[model samples]
Target: MLLPRPLLTLAALVAALAAPSVMAIPGAVVTTPQVRAELVAHAPEGLGPGRPMALGLLIRHQPGWHTYWKNPGDSGLPTTFAWTLPEGASAGDIRWPTPRRLPVGPLMNFGYDGTLLLPVPLTVAEGFKGERLDVTLHAEWLVCKEVCIPESGDFALSLPREQATAGQAEAFAAAEAAKPVPATGAQARARIDGQAVVVEVKGLPADWQGAALDVLPATAGALRNAAVPQASWSGAVWTARLEIDPQHTESPPALDLVLVRDGVPAGLEINAPVSGSWPAPADAATPAEPAATPAAPPADTSLGLALALAFGGGLLLNLMPCVFPVLSLKVLGFAAHAHDRAKLLAGGLAYTAGVVVSFVALAGLLLALRAGGEQLGWGFQLQQPGVVAALAALFTLIGLNLAGVFEFGSVLPSSWAAARARHPLVDSLLTGVLAVAVASPCTAPFMGASLGVAVTLPAPQALTIFAALGLGMAAPYLLASAWPRLAGALPRPGVWMAHFKVLMAFPMFATVVWLVWVLGQQAGIDGAAALLALLVALAFAAWAFGSRSLGVRARTGFGLLSLALFGATLAWALPAWREAPPAATAAAAETGWQPWSAERVAQALAEGKPVFVDFTAAWCVTCQVNKRTTLAREEVLAEFRARGVVLLRADWTRRDAAITAELARLGRSGVPVYALYAPGGGAPRVLSEILSPAEVRAMLAELPAVAAPA
Candidate 1:
């Protein structure tokens, strides 16, 4: 029978006043001054013989330390309890109270800071209530602060069999009420715009601050503690742009968000939605869309302008360092066919068709992957080792071919060189394919905005944008092919053509070298060595094929050997794809240069230190040029140092998931992202992709005086 409220309250008061001593069970104390256990309770209050009673496992931690909850945020371990009860008795799960968020330098951990009461409910057997109830439990918990220590203990509780009064039940109920509650209506929706992971959360209270918010992963190895998440508040919504851990595997499981508002515990369980939709559909197309915006005149105008810009950007790409080599070759082909207008027109049209077809295929693949719930970005192709290795090999072979080391099929075997000179169409079509391939590495201006929109738009619209880009890229080549007079106006092919071709080979070789370097960054030194070996083998095979004395069999043998080498390399390199290491740039001491980390940047800004972050990639020629011509110069470094500027280098050489996410956080998807944190509290000053020395100096000069000496 349930006891009266007044009587239950009186019993609870007596128990509190008694302040019973906590005795350690046999083998319970693993370390000195700390007792660990599975169960603990007042002696006489235990269940009767053969009956189990509710028991509390009091984990009294060492001073300045504590244990953990099931979801250990940032750091710490959960306290596990294994029970061994007397015959006819059963034990219930432990009830855990809300934990406090512990900040250890750059990392955030969830754990108890002091003593904790873990109460476990026990079931008393029918007709077993008699004399005494004995229960045993084994428990383990991890305690930490800067460093971590794991501890374990065995504990037992004995209680008398009696009709438990209402007083005891009320006391236990109050303790249970203190347990931490999980956050409800917790949803994590993410949008991949450019290179950022803009994660939005709903059902959160207004004025949500970082201190009260903690992001926990529901699955193991989902989010890294080292990765910093920047939080912002807009009314009832809270958004956190977390640097997706590059080390984090793709398509991570659902994330658990623990929200503590003014110490009131709430929980949010969020899985990466299959697609970005409200009441997210199981078969949603993309992860999520950007927040809705009204259809304004500016929005339409901006999109039209973006399309125009994409066309212009595609045209400009033809002149880029990487694309120029193929363009020159195409020009040579056009010059040779200038006298034949029909052939010229056919060649141009064919080349344009190739460009459009390739672009359409790429767009289709990207969309298909998105439909299958994959997160992809503009330069996602470069993330694949096989792709990188193949491109490297192709460039090397092209270099050798252009240097007259080998020849393709020709009608006149006796005068193969003359035959090659006669057919400009072959070179023209190949050049078109080559241009698109090379242009993949360099993201031109206006391309990011367009591509970002394309990836999120319907398939047809996306393909149209892609086709427009292809048309722009093929425009110059098509013009030369369609108009013989224009082609004839150019210089005739001669020895200079050979020299130019040879010159172009160096650029191709340069591209190969850059790719190899990126491979090293992605797969580590061992992977890079393997790629290098593959390249050497390919070069040897080409040389063998070019040899005049080599028979068809011998040439085929060498070709097979090269293919085998590449296959072996791929076997080793593919699985080892990883983020590239941070860039190693020499900076003046005064600049207080440090490796780029989101936490460090936050701390620096909090401490009132101005920061300048250089987001660059080794494979980006523009980035390299900016580094050499501006940022790395002694004058610039010294000036930065003298002013106590904090220098942060965010390297995106290979496929860095974290840096990519960080870039996305800043509303960018590519490299050469520069942002300056100024003193006196203002938004960071964002610099353009192309930075001149004067531009860097001027930005520095405009900053306030250094608060601390370098």
Candidate 2:
């Protein structure tokens, strides 16, 4: 049934030629799931040969979706209109309406929701012989909720010449009201100051004084879309400090700005000229707003409360899935030194120091990167594919080591073994580091609020909060080491210890499996396969070096072979990791859970359906636990179905700026956030990080009648 390439193309062309042509109508309408678009026009004075015509593409969006403006801002394509007309007729550019700020995730877009009108002017040349004035338009636009969809329409309109046809007068009147007006007597100038742009405007009407003005850039890429403008007034001149987008470095000759006050639609337009020389580029991007804005923690949140929450969250972290794999290692270390109080105490302190230092260092680096304008949040390291691959390799080695594939001291030369023996505390410290590495991906309950506040605070305070979290995580072990009685209670070292250690290797291997899956979520299946191959080669390398059955000479040769095999595998794997495609989205239909989008949530609510959104990540152990146990239970699903609730999953395995922004808007900065939305449009009820089947059922049962099927 397969057709050849040339025949298939010819068949498609023949099918198109057979299709019926749509006739031109005065007001042509097209409807899609997201928008209802109409081409409306007016010829005020009956179409004279040289008279101009006003045509508008008016779109009415579905409850939750919106289309882009002339300057889409940050991420979307602007709506475009291509015209087809007779030889003597010409169409001008679309006169855009004043756009409103639509904040999506972390990015800010300039667009319109509900209804949009884009007006275009058409001119007819002298001596037009055609009896009818015909206009054909091919238009394209990107409509967005949380997700964006590209849509286009082809429209044809005809108006009889010499007959004045009254058109959609109301729509044209509204379009005129929504358009931007000239700032009659205002004068403005702009200058670059470091990474910031300073705009000074003078001679505005005296009545407009003292009102807070919202400044929007008419030129795309001129300013950071999400950045809050800093403005102050002095006498007749008003100065506003705005962040210049680092991606677009060179300033435009003239910065076009829209100034709005009191949520007005029609705004004053100012074209400001750049008057100063540009400064040398900085080595790194810097924050335009060095001080925290009002979005940070409120004054009521004391430093003590933040530290307390951080410490408590860290203590609970030990029980999270990400940290469970490391516990066995710690248990083995404790068993080896149960009877030796001095060594046990030393190891514990070393581990605690390791944990604290690592936490502080990671927090400091994250803070630095964020100050430099990176839209990052908790568990940032795992967001990098390279980092995930490295972690995979690391865990594989540890698992192989614990499985007795490699003996550090006996596997190789004596010098290496002696060095390891001399540095027992170093091993303990490294174990602590590994523990933090895994634990970082899990955001325990109290940790979210504490860390959210920490990021906005001064460096010293932020670090202190991080230090407190580490101390809490290390506290249980620290306490056990300090108490000789607890060590006495532990079973004495025996031959059974060896078996227990081997059993512990399974958890380490499990950790490796989890890490590979996490990488797959970030870099697709190819990346995961690469990491697996690398781990297999590494296992063989460990085996070749440590297998005592082989003679010394044979072992040396195989060791060399192992090294070469691993090197070759690594070379192949590295490229896969670097060139990997973005995380693959799972098919939503199969799981009965739609991918989360702000628009989807809004639409569902608008339809009177209760919504439950699971803000989760593959790397978070707690998220997986709640998902498999409570949320996935038959009872929970039945209840959801009974209540007509829509399930949405916001996957945070990969770095999503939109998801990050949503978390921030929800007053948290990390995942395992559960939001239950009732039918009506109000704040969704946030659930605890951990969930229970009983609690879920109770919440569902409590839904108002509106959410239940009528």
Candidate 3:
């Protein structure tokens, strides 16, 4: 059979070309901005009917970022997997590894950094007779460092019907070793001891008895993640006292506890029976460790208390600058209907209905989004540039209407005008809607606490609280309308009323100005300028359509020209609205404050400097007021300089998940949140929603003096 080398090679090449095509792969890889994901599979034995296989989603994170675990502590979402398997195949849940404690600002969370593998066991039906196993995986995870980003990937893998030991054996082994095992020799139990849950385990291995152990609640929402528990060994039994999470209202029949010891690769898992029931909602403990976690208003706050607070907050919102403009418009409506009792009563009821219904709708949407793992809160709509732009345009039109630049009835088609006149209360209803839209950005005094609690409660209870807020807001007008004497005291509708209506238009213009500024903060100067141009074009269109002096043909031509101009401007401006704003150099320079990040704060603290963080948004009137009156004061700035304090502003004008998480950690869902972190590793002192110069001075005084270079 011996032959020349060239002849042999030619024969081999011809044979290879004649071979059948076969597609076999160990797995697939997919990449995103923050993670590299791989769908890897391994079968020690040959793939056959009813044979079990190990499949895993291997996630390799970029440096400084991490994804959440199955039970993401405090404020994060766990990774999820959706599989597409061959017919008659099934998969088990992911075998999660022991997660590390991640400290975010003042909060503690449990997650994996670097690389992690979520392994799942899969099995095919015994009757299967396929030549190969085809599978697909859809994976989603929230990756976070300074900010959180939701990322996902899809992958497919085809495995031939043979022994597939060729895949990542070492990776699979490591993941298997990382999974927690049952504590075979140990018996554990838990009981409520005042504000803490006391967990005790007996018959642990002698070597593990005296070692320092890291405890994690396998059951989510059972124990406070941020609260550090006290652990000790009493004789042969290990005991730990953990703070109970307020959300955990009922006593669990069994507690899934995970215990990790240093120098160990895997943890010990225990299903411990609970002895005592959780305390009543009103008796839940308020967090005492200011350094560990900001005192969160209890999530289990009584329904009546939460409702009352929401109502009070809504009533107080009427005084906030954000709601003042819309209330003024309502005033104009009140004066016009002062003489008609029946009409006033109907209008008030309609307005109340609008506000309540709108609030419930909004609450439902927020809850749904949150359940789907969105990091959002109250006033979330203003975070969208499109919403802000739309609001600005809407306000501009309202202002024009009030200023007599256009009459609704005269400008609209005859049928439309007739319908509006016949149902005049519709205007009142819409005005109520407008009031809520404007008022959303402002978190009134009691409102902050109530809303913070509402977001954590059940949907029905949360919606009820929101409804109470709406009713309170509509109460003032409701009262005035019901009491005919108050309306009787008003001057009759005349030239003076017209003058007042025109004057009230100024506030609407002011609101438009604010919205444009807020848009600038989110989308920068270019976007704001484009919006102004669009607004000018729109105003022109409105005027052309409303002009009575021009002949029909002339008016029609002018209107068409204006409409074309507006359409052109809108096309150019929309892209600008989506564009990210430039770096906030000007604001930082003006205020002598830097932008906030967890690393920056840690670095400042490491260098023995106090850090003050201002969690705020441009649309929040309360935040703007505090910025002007307290944060911008010369004395406060001088104090900051004197103490070597680092100032950081977390602008929440746009949607930022990191800031949202931080606010959640601070027991707040919306901002104007101020926290002053002193050097030397102590808890930060959180300031009130409304800050005063004296309070700022006093808080600044708490900073320890830094010694001069020795």
Candidate 4:
């Protein structure tokens, strides 16, 4: 026996109701009607003939529950309604009344908590005077208290033509006209400040509170979403922080501010203008500074202080974690040639020259990038996968060599080695290049500031600064070689020298490990694995090439095979590595946190929740140390949970454009940037790069006191 059509439809509806509905509104938990208004359709009781029938969305809410307006502040979905009307009848968009700002905790939600009327205007076609009008509506809305719940209802209303009235139509139309026109008269402004572009807005309403205002950048990827706009009020003026996209080199034509106040849209526009001067070309002579602060300093007292500092800094770099491994080999060389001051000095000078030359080259590259309107900074080279891959390969080779897999003792061309062996000057120049390569990782304390100025200054000034850094890096070697007596005071070479060589190998191996890790960050696990395989193959080839019994042709073939593998690895790995998605570096299991994204942060903030952002990188030792020692502690996790803080980690292991832009906005170019936001009013407090238990406690303590439990 077949079921009737209506019965079948009812059965289908029952099945559909049995399954959970997929909601467009996220995080909503409870939804109920606040108020319900009845409408009699097609009735001429209130309106004249030929007028469209109307209905009122009588919205009623459970006490303390609320639904959203068109512009859901910070994070709620706007109420939407779809109508199914009979033929020759049409309904206009929902007419929203002005909404109120509701602060739940730290977040500001745009909505209404009590009963309200949302008038929907319906039109009937001319010459159609119906006795009865039928209308259906599918209404979806988000209702919230602490958490939000989405709800929808299918509603139908019927009215007799005799009951329809014009007064009712006029009343609904008038209510809609009174709904606030999207707030206008506001505008945005932006300016370039070094690496960051600072954007500000003006003409916001004077009576506005923090919970009532929100600013959204119109351009995708032009601004970092994690950046919290710092809001300040001075009399009638409003100022807020807007960090520009650090990756943006050219000035954007215009900035669109999607400002919302209490669920109402306040559209604003601002134009960005280019202002800063460009660096001089590499070949150009350095320009003179103003007489007030002359480039040429007072000559008598410390003629070469900058150069000496650079050289000293370079020498100290041999002790830096990154440079120590490479420096150990040079130390061995020094021990071997301890008796020959000429050879030591010659090699030292050559190394110094190499360091200077490389620095000059780096400066030139920076200048070139600036001239082309590319925004770049120190460590920018490392951002390139090709550069990172090459470094990885170099470190791997060095590690293998140190492990006694092969000898680079004769790796240099015989002609060049012979010349260097005969001329100390040549040896020193080559040593300088080695020194610079080893020192690449340790951009010591004063280095960043100097480099920043160099990249922005004229050619001569930049070169001079570069020379100073190179000189500092090479100074220790130069100093040892310069004073033979001091060198002689060093312990005599013996079997201990062999032990020292092996010990030195560890540093090179350590460097290899660091490089591999960096590669993993840049290329993902797959890319890292491929590169590692290439290194192992190269090690095998070196072993084969060095075998005394192997025929020349066979050895040559093995070497060529290794080269091919390395080349193939480079070709396949570079682009894939560059495009790898960033993974969270911080151990979030302890904090029950996830990697941060703009959308997630925005959503959380919109819902009136406090947020904590941890910006960290895998390669940064300090960041790791802090994570393990302080941040990951159970006590800290408990505190975060107790406070209801939304934990977000912005990982910067690789060159993440979003992370970089965020850093730039915070007046920083490197991790770790820790920020804590209060519920609504207080400005966020930025934690120190090197976090401590006490510091974290102090910062957390500083947060505005949470309301006492009821």
Q: TM-scores for all candidates? A: 0.57, 0.62, 0.66, 0.53
lDDT of 3 by residue, 1-710 (tens): 11112333677667644533223232368776678888887777756655557788988999999988788876667888999988877678999998888877445678998989899987877776776778888887878786565566667776666645436778889988989999888999988888688899998888888899989887886677778879999888999998877545345778898999998888999888888877644322232222332444555556788899888887888888888999897788888889999988888898888888888888889889988978897889999988998999988988888898877665799999999989888988888888888787785445776777787778898899999999888888899999989989988889899899889989999999999999998889999998999999988887788766667888799899999999888887887886666554445777678777654676577666788999888888888888899889898888888888888888888887767876766667888789887665555777888899999888877766555567
Better TM-score candidate (1, 4) = 1
TM-score of 3: 0.66
lDDT of each: 0.61, 0.77, 0.79, 0.58
Give lDDT: candidate 1, residue 703: 68
Model 1 regions lying over 4 Å from their true place: 1-298, 360-375, 410-430, 445-466, 491-504, 545-548, 552-592, 678-683, 707-710
lDDT of 2 by residue, 362-388 (tens): 999988987886667788788787788
lDDT score for candidate 4 against the true structure: 0.58
What local lDDT does model 2 show for residue 687? 80
Q: What is candidate 1's lDDT per residue for 381-463, written digit by digit as tens?
A: 76676777888988888788777677544112657666566765565666677677667556534375566566556788777
Better of 1 and 3 by lDDT: 3
**Candidate 2 colliding pairs:** none
State the local distance difference test value for candidate 3: 0.79
TM-score of 4: 0.53
Which ranges in model 2 have alpha carbons more than 4 Å from their true place? Answer: 1-108, 111-216, 219-269, 272-302, 410-416, 548-553, 578-584, 602-610, 642-644, 677-682, 706-710
Q: Alpha carbon lDDT of residue 542, candidate 2?
A: 77
Q: Tell me the lDDT of model 3 at 507.
A: 95
